[model samples]
Target: MRQLLSYGLFGVIFFHLFFPHNISAQSVDTVYFSLDMTEPISEGWLKHGTEIVGIRGDQSPLNWGNTFEASDPDKDGIYEVAVPFNLHSDSLLVSFKIKVDGVNNPDDGWQKGRNHEAMIYQGVKNKVTLKWADEPPQAPTTITGQVEIFRDFQSDNLVPRDLYVYLPPGYKESNQRYPVLYMHDGQALFDASEIGQEWRVDEAAEELIRAGEIEPVIIVGIGNTQNRFDEYTPTEQVWRYELNRISSQERTTFPEAFAGNYISTEGDTIRFKTKHDTLLTMIPGGQFWQPLIPESEHAFFLAQAGITFTFDVKETEVNQVVASKPTMGGDGDLYGGFIIKKVKPFIDQNFRTRPEREFTSLGGSSLGGLITLYLGLEYQDTFSNLLVVSPSVWWDGQMIISKVNELPGATNQHIWLDMGTAEGEGAVESAKALNKALLNKGWSKENLNFVIEEGAAHNERAWAKRVPDMLRFLYSKN
Candidate 1:
């Protein structure tokens, strides 16, 4: 339901957005996205020529009877609206969607989004994004490339999905075929220079490739779907188990109940035990969070509320837990043709990469890491190398654990796996299981490598710090 609500919100948002300056259905000025401001703008936007195309306020709701009149839309911050009139002249007026994107850049909870003009979304980023207009903007000479990060505008497929493709230093002058690094979660992988962290894959790749430390690999970072669990899990759910229940009067409301592969890690894991049910409340001004209840009683309270939940990997079972579709990513596992074939093709072709499997690689973190493992092992013909970083190996399905023993030997492939020691007990076990599994398969140290960082936690900063080395390990011939 939470996921459904989010999707519903996005539908309303996208519609008003595409039609931002209302045009009647039968009107000749009929156009979808006629006066669109798809990219978030800064406070002082300066452009040539001028005309009042139309003004449309965001459509979220008048906040709490405050007749607020407008909502600073989350996506791109365009203030989606509808207008009966058109721009007064053949010339188009430059409008402004000034924003102050801070730690979090707002979007419709879709795409790789950010604040209006936060430090991260300024400057060099101007060259990275291609504002979605009727025609590409006549960007300044300094602006090197224009790109778009897209996702399905449908309820059934609303994921935090996107990709980043870089243009060579002199892309406009040459038609070159560069090697590609098809990364997972392209949105969050790059440095904060693009409203992201500072592992600047582009800067790193461009420099190293130029120096011959690694091949010149154009990176395409695929964002994780909001529902990563769905993408990572192979079976409908993660695991399957039955539940039988009876009440005091020997009366039962239902005969069975379960959730697929969605295990209760809090029960078996010490790390989770220390972390209670916490919620981060992000209001307009600032964000803060705390344990929902006193942590001292968290355990006892949970035991009393035993919600009779079990894990399943079957569709018939998942439908019962979630009558509709998954609301967020990483609930279980995900592996499908669209990502394996469609997305991969899109990145490869656009970057003019070598059209062979030998130079190709797949990499990801956490659930994405698990999926990378699954993809490489299952489709070795397509992806020859795997870079799985700090994978949530304990995900109920034990997805990785179950599949490592069956992977192709190291002789024909290379695998770079790492975990942070700070992630707690399961981290060590997961790494050990993987190490043992590969070793038992006659894999050598040359083909498989795993690292355990002493203090790295499960966050973007930690990943960003190691991204450079990971890239080197995966693509560097040196």
Candidate 2:
């Protein structure tokens, strides 16, 4: 079923329709799904497919709502459905739900809290085969420590957030205070129910502490909201040229008829600019897919939520592109400032904290890693230990290096930088460059530790494997 709706843009009117059923018929691609449900009914009397609907395949609900109907055409209890849509990007991250017949109760569905995710590869017709989930999400194995989950922890500098506090063995029995490691991506760090893989920080910390390789420490896992990118990177906006500098000899590459209008040369760079009353709509069959433009010219990242885009023009010629720098927020610099100004205080006050820079550390991976570096530098007075796993040195055109260069000649900062070989060739080079820059900036060899793991890829499992080393280096007391 569909319903007609009305809309207006500054007096301009249009009619829009809402889809209550599957909208795959209007898509450019499709996912042919097959499921085996031969087993007797356990919960739901009837079954249907509910997905994390979106432009891409992620769990976000930007384009979610309608449940696609599935049928066992061959009477084998093997249901099937075809989901069609243009993937948001090159790949899609989504979770599917099996709903009971016309029931909306909590116990009416399988894989309720912890759902199964499917990665849909774009540009190809997919044939996905699935079986009925016999059980729920896998539970975490018991570790040697304790994990306390605090929900809706309030902070004036940040939105209401969750906090996972990990206490080493004998923490309750002893009156000893310990150093603290604050990490980001809290939801995905410790629980398999949230993300398919977990960093297992608690397990790593417990093992290291038990072996005496590292002193007992408190691990604080801070939960991140939807605006994760903005909270992790320091810069508010990043500017880059969308079009590269085209040589004068290549002027014949473009049409000469619209030289001044469609394309203009700014010094060594070629530029294009256009304006509209509301939105720019590329007409249908605009040769967008197969253009005469060079392959390099056609490559561009589409702007999405949290990523703001703008046109940069000088004297009416739009030649540059400006977009919101990916990470770092404003309320306490968003996540960093929140951790230093608000979170640290809360932890120090409530928990048995060392309450000193030498005993305070911050760490995370990827964007989280980048923000940890930013936070440590910006608040060197507060944090003396830093653990950065695969820091995004490429962020903001590698502007983070400039930040590193600005550090004083000597500081009591102990830093760790690590990357995996599987992260790609650029990662190795970036890690090396950052390590060199840190050394050149007066950081001592003993104080800075950089490691490259062999055959390792970027994920929670990989990070978990390296957590022992990170702990030993950052928390080793001589």
Candidate 3:
């Protein structure tokens, strides 16, 4: 293990390596990361001590980033540590994993697909707001519902996928068959650690049910696997295109790569010549520029560039492509088919559900939304109602809309298409165009509801607020 020696008034850093060769460590300000485990530890929740392991940035001699033991100085279970190393660059974005005892240890409780992240500049100090190992927010006491996870649900045709079933109140007591809403991103819909915000669908359903605004329905949230992006995309073609485009760094520079021409760079800030009508000083650096870069390599990118890029693009951009990987794309339609054939049957057999297409529904947000729309269109007989929230119609060069237009059908399907006003210009406009496409497909206003939410953004919290409205529209018998 390598140790980082901090420098003070003398401004000298010493590195103590395992081999006993003393080398001067670079001078950098100490960054403190504090984790309040008082609630979890004192309450007999976490028994194991936690260690913070830096997942990204300059782990060269440190054996895959630095691992520092958190000290509870006050013995209040509030562990605090001033990281041995300082921020070398302004662009340094660090991700830390709080292993309970250590990685691969049973006592080391950790959440899958959740990690503490920070954009650390020089002398920046941050705290882990959430509990050790991204714990799910406690279920609201006001809600009369519970989320049950179907661990490693097996499928003959496809890989294993977990299912989260949210049963409404009095479901077990009553022998009534309820409509089922199949949603993507099961892990995130209820848990905050998976994504920064949860959709709170369970809470929303309970509220709506109690208020009699919407009928009691069973929500089957299909937790995405490691191959989420590929599974969520409709066709292999779209998957291939996205995989190639995102992985291939053919165009990342200014003037030719990101659709914006390079104008000037004052310091590290490059002024790109904007030809687009929309006025913006900065956009989310990831959305436009990081389409090609994987997040795991962000530390490496930051190390190369002294300063990190900033844009007007908000936190919504982070949730958009979290599941994207550098692996080659495969057939997502097959994966979707597995859900329809294998998973749906298992759901129907286990729970009392309306198996008919009219009573069955599919929904998701972002890429999940895109796949839901595609599945709804392709398998119209399978799903009659769809909750499409901010579908990525821009995928495959906007091929989905064209495909929908080519398909001749006056199918009677209940569709709720919506986008937030605060969502990026492309997302908002694409959703509107999709609404038009649905209209052209013979969908009447009575069947389709197009909504542009006022001041709503693209995060899960934004989606949760609109859930009741979409549910009312889709399931209302009146």
Computed on alpha carbons, the lDDT of every model, listed in order, comes to 0.45, 0.59, 0.58
Instruction: Give model 3's TM-score versus the native structure.
Output: 0.57
Candidate 3 structure quality by residue, lDDT tens digits, 1-478: 1111232101110111111121236545444656666555665645432223222212111111223445675777666665544333453434445544332334334334444455556545544444454543444332237777888888776678788899988898999999999999887776665554578788878888878878889999898886776787765542111101122223333322332322221111212222332211122121232111112322111111111223222322210111111343345688778878887998899999999998999999877888888888788889999888877776665667887798787577788889886454345777878888889889888988899987565566678889878878876645
TM-score, per-candidate, Cα-based: 0.51, 0.61, 0.57
Q: Per-residue CA lDDT of candidate 2, range 97-154, in tens?
A: 5543223434523434455566778677777776665434575644336888889888
| Candidate 3 residue runs with Cα over 4 Å from true position | 1-144, 193-196, 237-330
How far off is model 1, as Cα RMSD? 17.8
Model 3, residue 230: distance off in Å is: 0.4
Segments in model 2 whose C-alpha atoms lie over 4 Å from true places = 1-127, 130-144, 239-332
The backbone clash count of each candidate, in order, is 43, 8, 5
User: Cα lDDT for residue 430, model 3?
Assistant: 78
* lDDT tens per residue, model 1, 34-73: 2234343443231111101222111111000011111224
What are the per-model C-alpha RMSD values against the true structure?
17.8, 13.5, 16.3
User: What is the lDDT ranking, best to worst?
Assistant: 2, 3, 1
